[model samples]
Target chain A: MSSDGCSSPSGPRAAVGDRVVPGPGRAPAGTRQPLVRFDSVWKTYRTGAEPVHALRGVSVSVMPGEYISIIGPSGSGKSTFMHILGCLDTPTSGRYSLAGTDVSSMGEVELAEVRNRRIGFVFQQFHLLARLSAWRNVELPLIYAGVPRHERRVRAMAALEQVGLANRVEHRPNQLSGGQQQRVAVARALVTEPDLLLADEPTGNLDSRSSADVLAMLDELHRSGRTIVLITHEPDVAQAAERVKRFRDGRFIDDGGEGR
Target chain B: MSWWETMRSGFDAILGHRLRSGLTVLGILIGIAAVILTVGLGEGATAQVNSAINSLGTNLLIVSPGSSSTGLVRGGFGTASTLTYANALALGNKRDCPDVAAVAPQVQTGGNLVAGTTNWSTQVIGSTPNWLQVRGRSMAIGSFFTASQVKTDANVVVLGSTTAQELGLFNPVGQTIEVGTVPFTVIGVLKSAGTSSSSTNQDDMAVVPVTTAQELLTGTPTVSNIYLEATSASTMGAAGTEVTDELLALHGITDPANQDFTITSQTSLVQTASSVNSALTFLLAGIAAISLLVGGIGVMNIMLVSVTERVREIGLRKALGATPAMVRRQFLVEASVLGLTGGIGGAALGLVAAVVVPHFVSNQIAISVPATLGSVAVAMVIGVVFGVYPASRAARLAPIEALRSE
Candidate 1:
């Protein structure tokens, strides 16, 4: 056992080769439990009778107010990992704790509660209800969270305002520009003030200019103490995050030789 | 949000597709109208029949000379003439039959009623004072003939409204009207009793004393029919039975089958007519219900298409934290809106049909608004019932998969 609480670089921490270690200097200032933790998580899907392992013995931890990026190629299990972190799917064999609660053992209803109350998801498609106005789309999370009508309206409006979409609140997805629509999605994600904001290729469908705009907004959200986990196949998008974990063949590979 | 707001939001969604919603509602409207119109026509016809029967007389029985089956196949009068003056008198004298209010013998004869230059063919009936009370016919102008006039074979006469109008006798009270060659004085004119299309003779009729009618026309004292009145409405059936038994005994007939005269009551005739009307109404309603079923099926089909089209919307809502119940409620609200709007339109159409059709075809047709409302309610139920499956299917869709779809 080590005398200090921090694991030594030459000790058992070195045995797990190529695993990015957390830097001692980057430890959170305040004492708070990790918002997300995955222990020996294994996810398998049956393509016909043969089981294909998507994630094998993957362990990870995410603290509050941390901006992380998950980078991978096609079929590298990054999407599956995003699904697990967003509470949209449970790991087949692992203890997955979210917001200090072991969600791997939670029932469907509890998982839905977690998804509703703690996790906000943004998809590459912008996933805004096409029939609803930007404001109504943002209010969707509050509706799920059972927020009162007046407060929900206020919070949704404020979220839209935060995303600088105050004037486009009444515009539907088709009526708004691609960048504006993504901002509306962002507003929706932040409306409930969830513990985690998960974005998966959020700017994949946007042009470079719109992509930079969305990336800047994400960066601002990170600086404002929002915990964001974004997934992307592009290195430029991943570089915008404080930390990037590269996934390949169901395993994490360190590229910059830095801690998580 | 309040439940009302939720409902209102659902309503807004339904209204968003105005044309589709209107078309779906049209199906329900037609269904409700069919049910209401069919039921209304049947009920109206029944009411007309009952009124027609009652117009004949309250205590009157139509004793045709033959039985229905015998007349239908044999094409002649059946074997039985138990109806006589003596039988009428015996029924009137029965102490045990308190229901026997009065009895009057009647004989019908067709003749030309002539007054001055006007001449009209009319049915001349010979009846006593009891006929007026039993038949529910009273003198509108002059008084009906007294019992003495019937016994003495006097030439007093009463004229029906049509008969008086045809003869150009506006107020010919105490005026003599010649029937064939016999001169009879019209002592009274009857009030207008509306005639049914089924029976044309009801409008054209004349009444005279029984003896005078027998002596002038048939040249015999025998009567053709007997009209009887019950003491009260409640004892009509008892009165009919007593009159039948007394007539049978007086004619020395042992078997009821052997008797000639038919004893009928207004209550029985009215009851029979009402039952027939009920059956007709059921048949009409049944036929209409088939159309309603088709309309309901149309609603279901449209709703299914709507659900499929709105799959993406449903998915996004679910992804945003809408429970399955909320999704179901939204669809249900949409369906109910369709049904409700359709019901209103159908009811309006039916009302127009009820009002307009009667004027063009006949004035007797009646439309009941409550019946229309009932149909509307039924249409709404059909909409809800048909909408459930499609709504549930939309609600049960997986949020992620739905959102992923284009």
Candidate 2:
């Protein structure tokens, strides 16, 4: 993993509009570029007799190990932005690259491979299959990755341990509490060792205590040098990230906030 | 996913909805059972016909009067009185028809048999002493009439077992019976031959001398038919041809199509019976196949509903990195398993029915192995063919749209 703005735990954060320089690391120059780069991406939906512009010329970049939050009310294009970032939908125009590979024009099969190997998504609904246990849910991505069964089980157990759900590996999603289900989803997201973690309203269905626990888990992951992108409408959730980007009417607006 | 894992998931899905899956299987089961029963009864009928024909006599040939055409309308077999005792005599000449072993000339007429106070209508067959040899029959009491009796035109007769029984005479030899007011003495009794495959009772007639039948009963020299037995089964074909040629020469018939006589071998009779049986079998199978088609549609309908109900699950799997091909494979395997299971169950049921039916019905039920195997294969094909559209529909679902479904 590469270190950027989030390397120092107690130092004063860089001001807004300041470019994040590479921190002291052993990575070569070729690998120190931003992990995510989107140059004026656009998305248009034509579902209901007219074209709906879900995204319009949105441009952004994020360095490695940075925790960025995209906050917007409903119908503000935040979900569309998360979809594009998670590789679930393709951008209509402009360049979108992840880990140096341009993915804007990729086909469905290639995009699926990218989502399986490079990106992990945490949806608001948890999305755990009701039939499978927590460990089996975590093992799903590795199963698609063609990993051996024994090794997939081992890595799934390790991920469950990371989310503090080590004792609940055999419990199904319905048997677990809302906070525990969210933790299982997190473990599932991390099991593939993806380069980017995309959390979309991770605390939307949880109580305050579970939401606090989930936010604290994301903060810990960011501190441990993982790239995290959080999408939420809650101010407290946005405050946990090092930077916040505001959106309204299908375009990004200036939130004007530095790391706190 | 590995093939083992795919199969496991498919079986689990089938097991999850027990009632739905069972009903689907039942449809296929009924189809397969119908196929088995139809084929089994057809095969049994064919075997019964074959055995009946075989029991008549392996190397016997029957020479009957051929059709007679009058302008546009033509008559069927035994319509023309072309066969005669002269033809039998000429065929019996070993130097002329070396393939023939024995010959019997028959003259048949129906009349009431009178014995004391009992009276019954029965066919009286007039033949020579060689009738028993050519027909592969034996006397159960007393002895067969000698050739001397036929030559002398004696009024002695041999009674069939059923004829004797109906006359209330267990020991009918030397007893006198009236045939159209002519009293004839019974000399022997033939053993019962049971009912033929064509459903004709072969034991309800009496035998007499052809000479007596012609001069006294019918007052004509014409005989109804002639039966010839070959020296061996292998010579039956040649014996039939020889009889045809000899009869045509004796009648001075030059054109082959205008022949006065028809010579038929036992093998040809068996062949005709089996061909008719096979045609009936095909007709029955065609009717049964309609049910199989309906069963396939049932599978398709159920699978389509399953796909619709599990749209969100499909989306979840896709988002979890499952390929479209994998989704299709899982559903296809599930449908095939249902078909195969139903096929096995139906075959077992059909076999049990075949075994148990003989006690209640006279029709034989034969379970042919090839037909059973063929039904099983067709059932599996039905499943795979019907499953394609539903599985492809599931595979084509968009991940985002499917996940959006509740």
Candidate 3:
């Protein structure tokens, strides 16, 4: 009787699954609304007088608790799509909304605010500041958001605990293992408690074991009703998400068999 | 983040690159220090010169012979040969020039003064008791020759402090010093007068009666120079004119342009010295300002490099929702802090230089606190003025471009 309703503790561990049920602490059904919406977005880059289209006129909508993946080849615009969704760049032409508010026409300051409040990003490179410790890195977004000192520490520590990185909070990125660093990056992204989490190739640099561990954490987060959109070129990584959209030459080749 | 947090983070980043930051600050430090030291030294020299000038009494005048041309060949014009002992008697008898307090007619002869084994080259000046009042001098021991001594042509002399020291005359009041083989008893020892108002040598001289000087040294009834003291500064112009007319009539020179003597007052000397000092100070300050300009360039160059290096950090902060103003403020704070710190250090360095250089060379030089403060202010101004462009560049960077730069 979980929210997603495909229950039976079937993925990796049924014993540990029974201990922590999926969607057990989530909001009731029909309470949360769609937070991110994309409508016929197109992104084109001009190189030497020749325009290269990166994203065709494609549209998709993501609800509050959906875990979706955009999978593609190397030049298939998956990264471009992630950049647009993360508000790091605006679409060349089209409407994009977060929490039903149109963000396509927003200025740089407004866009930055949207990025801070609505979308948290986790990059494959784990861009935790090299000089700062895990806790300080987690505090970066809050610092930008102008959170006071005492509250920033409290929230950053809470985020680290949620990623199981509480013990490694004081360690710098260079001092931590790859898995530990990725976890710290995740904690940083989650510290702001944004409405959507956009991760680009979260496990691209990890080993099989570390990849599995990362995937399991993503699955757990998805089940907890935290919306996650992951971009990757690997089918195995795409399969970890509940829905997958395959992109080819700036267009969706298939919406992963219609999410069925 | 709060502005304090941003500033703290920026400072921490700078601290992380210790060697580079130190090198950059060192350029500014040198620039500031150079400015301070140069200006300070100039100010100290000016003060010393002013003090030395002031040490000579202000109410005095010197009359020297003016240059004259005879058929385009410049030569010393012989004038007023008859205004000798007769004119001195006439000046002492005048009542119209009441400010004429004292007048000393001098005839000088330069030769070696011998005292036992000590043979010192010195000048012998012939004058009466009024020479002390005219020349503004005081005796450390004994007394100058009286009017009767000059009238009688007594073979007595007064030694200058330096001349006395060289002759080893511990009790020079009763000692006999030989001037050009003519033995003369020392009547007085002049006190130490460091330097005259015109920076002339006053220490190496001997004083004797005008008649004795004419008989023993020059063997001529002629005088070279005359020292005059006015009763009050208010009547100096009148006194100078009276003395000039009297000398002109006595010498039978009717043409004013053909006058032989030049008369100068203490006011003119002080005025000329002040103007010259002001010009020299301006020249020195201008040179020191060039160092501040160079320091400003250094600050600008370092700030530009810092902006480039911190591009990614700027992008990251922008992505996290920092405004352009915030980014600009952070860099500006860093630059201004560099300037202010360098200014303080430069001020301290300049003050130290001001203090030490004068001590080693002489104690006459003095550096004031206002000069040090001025240099520090200039350093800070240079910092802010040059720091703006780089800070703006860093702030205006597009987050997308900066983030993808890596």
Candidate 4:
């Protein structure tokens, strides 16, 4: 099944998997704004004499609580999309906003606050600091959010429990298996209760079994009403998502429509 | 994070490379310790000079005769015999010299002092009864000769502690000591006065009435020195002028330049002693400043290396929501910790050296609280100033580029 961006009068629920429940569903885009929007966004890197465009004229929308996958090979702008979406980088041209707030023109201090309060990130490398234990790593985003230490610990422990790593709270990243490390990363991303969760090649370094386990965990999080953007190149990994958007060069192939 | 938490992490980062951190601290430590020790040494020298001047008695002046030349050979000062004992008495009159509080005129001679079978060579000084008060000396045994003793030219002597000890007299009072051909009874022993500026020991000479010494000992009425104590500290200049004028008039030298005497105040003596030590202190302080600069450079070098090595870590922290200011603060804390440790360690080491060094060296090592505290403060500043460049470098790192760095 495919749901194009223009055909999203489906209360934003028809765009996801089959766990849709009957409730006071979300208003249409005509009434409520999309959680994330990108209009003709561009990203360029000036490494030497010439400028390199990592993202070019890309446009998309992600409704609240929608679990979406962005699939593209290396140099296909998927990483750039995740970076811009997470407020880690600003667009060179065009406009990009999260939850109706424009962040492209934000200063470093403001951008850091946005990243801390509004976005959660999980990297392919499982970028957990080696010096910290699982709970300490999970509590990092909350630390930036200025949460009290006691509350940060409690919420971090709760996040670890949700990821089924409560027993490994004090264990360091090196002490855990690859799948456990990815799970810990997932816990860290969810600890801040962010508006958006971005996972960049989260299973890229995991074995097949670990990859499937992480995907299943992400599927569970999606069902429980968490917004997630999974960036990857593997078709099988993209298959785990209810909706997928493909990218080529710096623009989205699914600009106006979506297909599998 | 709270400041304490941030500082703890900074401390952890510094500790990650123990040997490098320690070497950097050592550089600063050496500088701080040297400054403290040098300051103490300079202070000790100043204190020694002040005490030496103080021992000469406050607001006092000494008038010594000009050197006498004999066939191109000039005798030392006080050998001219230009000042007579009568000149001393004339100056001592309150009506003639109102500013002059007291005067002690003495005739000095060296002889083998004989007490029984024991004999010791010492300078025998002949002075009036006012000599004890004028020289700020007190008697340890019996008492000094009275004005009556000087009036009768009594054959009495007051032996110095060292001279009496040399002559093997435990209680020399009432004992007999022969000075040249004269036999004098020791009426008292003078309290020890240690040593002056040179090899002459003040505690190693004997004192007798000027009349007794002049009539039976030197057989001369000339005075070698006239020690004048002004009525008060403020009247020393007035007393000096009065003495010079009176001496010139008495010696029949109308021109002031041809006067046969020289007056040196205790203030001048103090100034001469301090000038030499001041030069040494200045050189030592200069060296200390250079060492501090070198130490500051060492701190900068180590901090730069730390910033470079932790690029990825910095990126991670930035991504986790650390602002540039927070990152800079972290590095600054690390740098300051290094400096503070060095300062505290150096101060402790300097204090220890101050206590221990005096045992081996003849010079006193004065411990100064302000100097110690000031050195530590300077060490802290050195750390902070040197830390700025590296900390700013760390703060400027872009999160994306830093994270992507291998």
Top candidate (TM-score): 1
Q: Compared to the true structure, candidate 4 yields what TM-score?
A: 0.87
In model 1, which runs have C-alpha deviations exceeding 4 angstroms? Answer: A1-30, A250-260, B67-82, B195-203, B220-222, B363-373
lDDT of each: 0.77, 0.84, 0.76, 0.83
Instruction: Please give, for residues A52-83, the per-residue lDDT of candidate 2 as tens digits.
Output: 99998776767778788888899999888888
lDDT comparing candidate 2 with the true structure: 0.84
List chain A TM-scores, every candidate, in order: 0.88, 0.88, 0.86, 0.87
The 10-residue segment of model 1 chain B with minimum total lDDT is: B67-76
Score every model by TM-score.
0.88, 0.80, 0.83, 0.87
Error of 2 at B305 (Å): 1.9
Q: Write model 4 residue lDDT over A1-260, tens digit each, in one string.
A: 12232222333332223222221232343434567777678899998899999988776777777777888889887778777887878999867768877787898999888888888888887878787899988997787677888999999999999999989999999999999999998999899888888888889999999999999998999899888888999988987876777888998776422212
The order of the candidates by TM-score, greatest first, is 1, 4, 3, 2
lDDT per residue as tens, model 1, B42-121: 87787788788878776565554444234445333534443556556667785956787877777877888889888998
How many angstroms is residue B280 displaced in model 3 relative to the true structure, after the best TM-score fit? 5.0
Tens-place lDDT digits, model 3, residues A1-260: 12221122333222221332223333333434356656677898986698888988766666678887888899888778888888888888866777778787888788888888877877787777888989999998888888899999999999999989888889999999898888888888888988898888999999988888888888888888899998999888988887777788886775343222
| Model 2 residue pairs with clashes | none
The interface root-mean-square deviation of each model, in the order shown, is: 2.4, 1.4, 1.5, 1.5
Q: After superposition, how far is residue B219 of candidate 4 from its true place, in Å?
A: 5.9
In model 1, how large is the Cα lDDT of residue B208? 89
Tens digits of per-residue lDDT for model 2 on B19-110?
99999988988889889998999999998887787666659898889887667777887788977787788889998799999999999999
Q: lDDT by residue for model 3 over B155-200, one digit each (tens)?
A: 8999889888888888889888788898999988998777743355
Tens digits of per-residue lDDT for model 1 on A66-144?
A: 8888899989998888877877677888667787678887765566678888888888988776767899889887876
Whose lDDT is higher: candidate 1's or candidate 4's? 4
Q: Who is ahead in lDDT, 3 or 4?
A: 4
When 1 and 2 are scored with TM-score, the better candidate is 1
